[model samples]
Target: MVRPLYPINAPTYLRLRDQIRADIEGGCWRLGQHLTLNELSAHYSVSNVPVREALLQLQGDGMVDMRMNRGAVVLDVNERFIDEYFDIREALQSMLMTRACQRRGGGVLMQAKVLLGRVDEAMREGKVRQLLEADHALQDAIGHMGDNEPAMAMLASRSRLLEAFRRARLDLLTADLMQLPVQGLAMLLAIEHGDPGSGCEAVRRHVAAMRAYMKKLLKIPEGRSRADASLVNVPTFTRARESTAAMPEASSTEPASPAVASPGPPTVLPLSLPPGRRLDPEGDGSNDNRSTDDGLHPPKR
Candidate 1:
């Protein structure tokens, strides 16, 4: 399983990492695509070292293939990918359910209930991004209950792939996608009932449903242009004697600020950004073919 460095206010690489993950999952980069490191560095207005590091993180998550000749190539989603993802999701979630049920004194129940409230509110308001984050928070609450690092790490990778596709093509996929809170409800019910089977089965059913939905979409031919994502022009990269990261500004008399602890549990999965910029991160995020301005980038041969 791939691990994320503890994000302290999210470093430039981590920030870039999440930004890119969101783009890929949100369908800005399309299903089958690839991008070179120079292309990405120019688009994000950051150095390629962070870009390379971020892509490495994505590679570990099975989100992309880092080829010597091809650089970063996006992997197409299909049935095999769905099955493998669900299989991993099931195993880790079952283990987490077992652990959470064993130790019920960690206030996991109350925390889950609160997160569920947030999920419900996000859905009611039709905020896709907020809803997605809330759903993951509910899952994190459960993982924290279990206190299982390995299970959480593996689960995070499997889920990033799952959620990325779901978020990207949500509207086209279904008229009613209400399973987010339903799954959370099932887990909460199991916790209250002290039965891991119910929660485990709930998650299993959810993954199965997602697989079916993905299969249905795969049958249709999507025509979103991968080449239209041409980004800001950047110069060729040089490998030797690159400058170091800039030091954070500090005051001579002022005391340094203490780190602000995260209010929520550490997210198992982080967001993704894409090299191609056909989809504007600031726009409505529609699936129709379009282009972004200076902030993002994409192009094809």
Candidate 2:
């Protein structure tokens, strides 16, 4: 299924909830910041109920919190929580990689190789969104290769959390982020040859590099260092699991948001992202073209 620009058939609350999630992931909302239902509803042009519902959903995801009188506030990252989060990610994704290697096909391998080239193109032009999308496509292809619906779904879900964490660390490691393609391209080559063992080793090294980069960015030792160092001194999130359960069923019809203006300078976006998903930093879609797989892909932003 294609990822919706907004929540599918969701009430205003759900729509607002999803937008908030997107905004948080987009860094539109800073950690430790409090958001009122009225404020969000106004911003998203929805009613208070949907906004409240959305905040509640975020709360459940440990991204927001509710106080006795305060509506909701963005959560601050804590050392313990961040470490636990990625620890879970490493465990799940490692399993996914192993499974994909066992039965991966030539088609999937070929697609991955093409995607890595897209990654190279995006990196050359410094297109952050393209890079992000290309990375997701590569990983999602691997997830599909696993041939297990549950594994694919789990990887998609967990990847979002990891994406948020990685995005937070991007600015701190300018050099490493720019150099990602070197290591990433090499990893894809290993995967393309059907060397599961090589793929595993390549991915493991990549993850280690990521961990090391984060540690260096935060000026802490690897493994022992907590990822929360990036968000320490930020505000804490209040739990909102109860709110997600409260969501009503999806609606049959709802209007999508108006298309956002294109980023200038000729950047070509996959038709799936279309217009309105975001503006290119460069504005020109074609200026920073990259190969993108067709279909409704998983969320990276």
Candidate 3:
């Protein structure tokens, strides 16, 4: 049997590497932020060796540039960089869609449906983490749809670049604007209906929407947008509420009303009377006023 690849839980070196990469992606290590081995060691509670190993990983990912004497500084998202990243993303998405079309009508379609439900839930409840993970799941599923190992690896490598863009601008965009999940659903419908053209068009539309949104964010024209200056008109907190109110209802397929259980029958308990007190468990007091058959004078002690 073929050995499975090591997971994210490997030895210290791999774990540290994953952590540092996550930090950079999360913007904790901002652009031009110099992260030294000593600082990383102190922050991560690991020795310099693992930190060094993690830094090497970042260097390989092109997120860190090592200076002569200054150690590693994170790369800034420049205009050229954004343009190149989007160009590459457009190509990868197209290729992945074509591959998916070839391997249609199976588990891939079912997985897409499941992911679409998750996305709808996230949108209805405004769960950001769920939406984000759903996005990754859709991408991973698509990458697997390629079926061939070589094709899958190629697409996976390209998808990482798009992920970096997503992470960089997560704050700028709202959950509603990140509609990849919906696009995935549409693509699934197109594929399951045996329409390769529709599938391709669906994927193309998804890619185009992302490109247009990113461009709008940068405030530059479609093709020449600059990353540094790109920002959408962010509504104030009050206006945000107004916009949500103006929005339409959620999906028709959301969960139905939940059923609640009614209270059960009241509990019964045994009782004991205190000294000199007549038994009146039911509060009738029938025996209190009347004398018993053999009573002397109600037990004078």
Candidate 4:
């Protein structure tokens, strides 16, 4: 009698949804890969009923695309998607922070402090997953303080996907790992002191930082570029100093600390071709032979 990994009493579809979402976020399914009902059912040892239902739920989460004949295909994670994601996030987070500051309560403030402490601990230990979870929890606490159900609901809908993206690209964020929590703390302190303006600004600045980091990670151009189309072959992360060595230095208002400061320039992850993949310099995939269904072939258990 072996115990099940998920709770036995939970609905089958819900369990399947969690498993599938985990696989999708874990890079088990690549961009544009079709997910067939029969294959998923067989892979998870579940019936088609649960698999279909779970995929429908995931579709609503914006994690998959359900076509007329294609069934479910992994959604494309592209520049447009990232831009829209951060835009929505910045608006929602600013609203939540403003309202939270307006409705500040001692209990919620104390809870936020506790959550921030957890974030700091996770950061110090270099536990990326724990740090992300704790940071999200802290944000949730702040949002709850506002008691804006609709706003919070919108934020929750896409939170997991955003977290998954950040988690997957941790290598590009070594500098951000330290800077972000400090921003979170600043936002929390502004809320604690009932400073809505400062709080909202803090939230916006934090989101801006994230937006910049993500754009750099994805190699998304600020404007149109010839190199945009060839981004399908994602580059590996490199150190900020190495990436920004050729750029001129810029002045900073914030005092520098040994832990956060880079020796060369501001941290940035520049594009470099990954090994074993040929990319055309003209932003075309003509030279690349990589499969679009990169993760469709699951390993045998």
Among these predictions, the greatest lDDT belongs to 4
Q: For each candidate, what is the lDDT?
A: 0.60, 0.53, 0.54, 0.62
Q: Identify the superior model by lDDT, candidate 2 or candidate 3.
A: 3
Score residue 17 of candidate 4 by CA lDDT: 88
lDDT of 4 by residue, 102-169 (tens): 87744677667667767765554444456666777877788888788888777776655654554445
lDDT of 4: 0.62
* Tens-digit per-residue lDDT, 138-193, candidate 2: 66676576667776665554444444544555323233344455445544545545
Q: Which candidate, 1 or 2, would have the higher lDDT against the true structure?
A: 1
lDDT of 3 at 263: 65
The C-alpha RMSD in Å for every predicted model, in order, reads 18.2, 16.2, 24.3, 17.0
Shift in Å, residue 291, candidate 1: 45
**What are the clash counts of all predictions, listed in order?**
16, 26, 2, 0
Worst 10 residues of 2 by lDDT: 230-239
Residue 125 of candidate 4: its Cα lDDT?
A: 44
Q: List TM-scores for all candidates, in order.
A: 0.59, 0.58, 0.59, 0.64
Over 4 Å off in model 3, which ranges?
A: 1-11, 45-49, 124-129, 148-182, 215-301
Query: CA lDDT of 14 in candidate 4?
Result: 88
Judge candidate 2 at residue 142 and give its lDDT.
63
